[model samples]
Target: MMLCNESRKEAAGLTPFLTPRKTIRLATWNIRTMYEAGRTAQVAKEMKHYNTCLLGLSETRWLQTGQLRLTTGETLFTKKSKIKLNIIQCYAPTNDTDDEKKDAFYQQLPAVLDKAGKKYMAILMGDFNAKIGADNTGYNEVMGTQGLGYINENGERFADLCSLNQLVIGGSIFPHKRIHKATWRSPDHVTENQIDHICISKKFRRAWKDVKVMRGTDISSDHHLLMTAVRLHLKKFKNTTNMRTRYNVSVLKTKEVRTAFHLSLSNRFQPLQDQIENNDTNIETQWKLEARKEKKVVLNTSRTRAAKAKAQEDYTATDKEVKKNIRKDKRDHINNLAKQAEEAAGQGNLR
Candidate 1:
């Protein structure tokens, strides 16, 4: 939380590069509790300015109940190769009552992947907060020989669910690289580690190469944001991928499902104005006609609603881009300082 009277600067860092095959690259970070207003502004700057196609942000500390809002707001998700494809940011409760929280996480997670359709290839990465179960990754502690290692107990379960569902764990951390382990560096230094994990599905693996982590840049926060990049497998025919698969029209798709209701309303009301004008003996039926008009009015209102929604998204993107450029300028300034210091060190030695 930041004070209303306080001043803060955005400070988000990211490394960007073009892939060999022209696929887009994406990265993930937990970013601690995003309730820190100052940091969230920075996260938006890095996420957007880097042109990240996918960002799995967790511990956003943003309660759906409106405890906070991302600098980019709820509608950052848009169409057009999903110019903005951000997923749910979660902070699964770690208390004693977290037993079935994994169930809740899975319940929510699959829907996103499903809505993402078959070919979009999501870059799902975040602070899973999952501890490796019992003596596996160099730590040797057991809860009862059964190895009930838990932190993201349910969060870990969800990560496994992602794997079982065919997602791939990317980076030096996980079943793939499985080296240079130990990401969660606790002050008390408990060996139970690797809570911050980066994962993606098989549909997105071949795109991820040379995945690595940022060793040390001690700012603050209990967990270091796991850093990894993936060159999104850009298909040759990418246009008709996510937006229009025949499978999209199903028992699911609540958003598109509303179209049926909308069309019905439109059919009933739009011609009513002419119907009333053409009929002379229908005055007694005014209530019925007005009811039909109401339905059409409601449906027609959606046209304006969609326009505003798109406009808002455009505005948020513009603001985010401006702020990100400013942060990049600041980072360049710091890099210049380090170079000057190194040059001075070299000159002093020459003397």
Candidate 2:
């Protein structure tokens, strides 16, 4: 059977472990197969109706593993977060499958879990084709008494894997009706079982609020949707460091740019030389005051048609002159850098 997991978060209170609390609604469903046309749309529509944020789908009958972005703007891919939650969705080998294949599947699962590391709250879920049953005797910490049906060989293996990884089976932890506990049913419409499961790290078990099967949801699949409600906030981290500036220096190879830069530099810095020698501060202040006065006159101009027209004409001319000077200044600045780089390259010291 195929499995698909979806997650949606609602803001809440503070948790003992993380920052402010958030209620994350996570679900896993065996979609069986998405090989038919419009099947993907049906799943996406159902996901939106349920208000899911992150949804992991399995047995899609697509090629190799990769991301699939739907037209509805929702993305299907493996979830990875630096803050806390790390989810791994799987469609394990069936109970009747070869023992070697099952062994290999279980062995590879641990490696995947290990890669998530201890810092993250890892969630391992999907259809394991395992029946954990209602027994919670020796495995009290790993599960609860609310599990459905009787444990099978696959269930024993699944339980052991959860135990080894210190994962708590979400389905068994919460009390619910028998109808709400079963995730899969037989094609003959007689037998029902709870094979699909959702598990979370034991360390964050408190974060898990509830888990149950949603039997009303229909997608032409034998497996029902199993959902887990977890309470833990995802804290956002931001980079505060300033970025360095970069410049292009290859234009220095042009002789026209070098000549323009030389002329601009001489015209601009020659005034600075006179200002420094004469210690002229009042002249600069006078120039600023006169410019402000011109703007004030424009603002206070009479509202007559002729006066307005004249004022607009003057403003436009001044604006054009200012823009022209700005362009010249920018071009000169670029040319100046190019000239400097050319000189440096000639000296064999381009740095």
What's the TM-score of every candidate structure? 0.44, 0.59
The candidate that wins on TM-score is 2
1-351 per-residue lDDT for model 1 (tens digits): 111111121111122233455655444565566566466566555555555554555565554531233445412221123223323344444435555765676677777767756554555556666654433332211111112244345545644555555565553323323323445566775653655555555665666664444434232566554555555556576565566446554644686767886877785575466546655323334544454455445555556778667655655555555556556656765676578568868888321
Candidate 1, residue 160: how far the Cα is off, in Å? 3.9
Deviation in Å, model 1, residue 245 alpha carbon: 38
Instruction: Tell me each candidate's RMSD, in Å, in order.
Output: 35.6, 19.1
lDDT of 2 by residue, 159-207 (tens): 9999999999988988988899998889997899998899989888878
Q: What is candidate 2's CA lDDT for residue 147?
A: 90
Clashes in model 1: which pairs?
167-201, 168-200
Error of model 1, residue 114, in angstroms:
1.1
Candidate 1 lDDT for residue 330: 63
10 residues in a row with least lDDT, candidate 2: 8-17
What is the RMSD of candidate 1? 35.6
Model 2 clash tally?
2
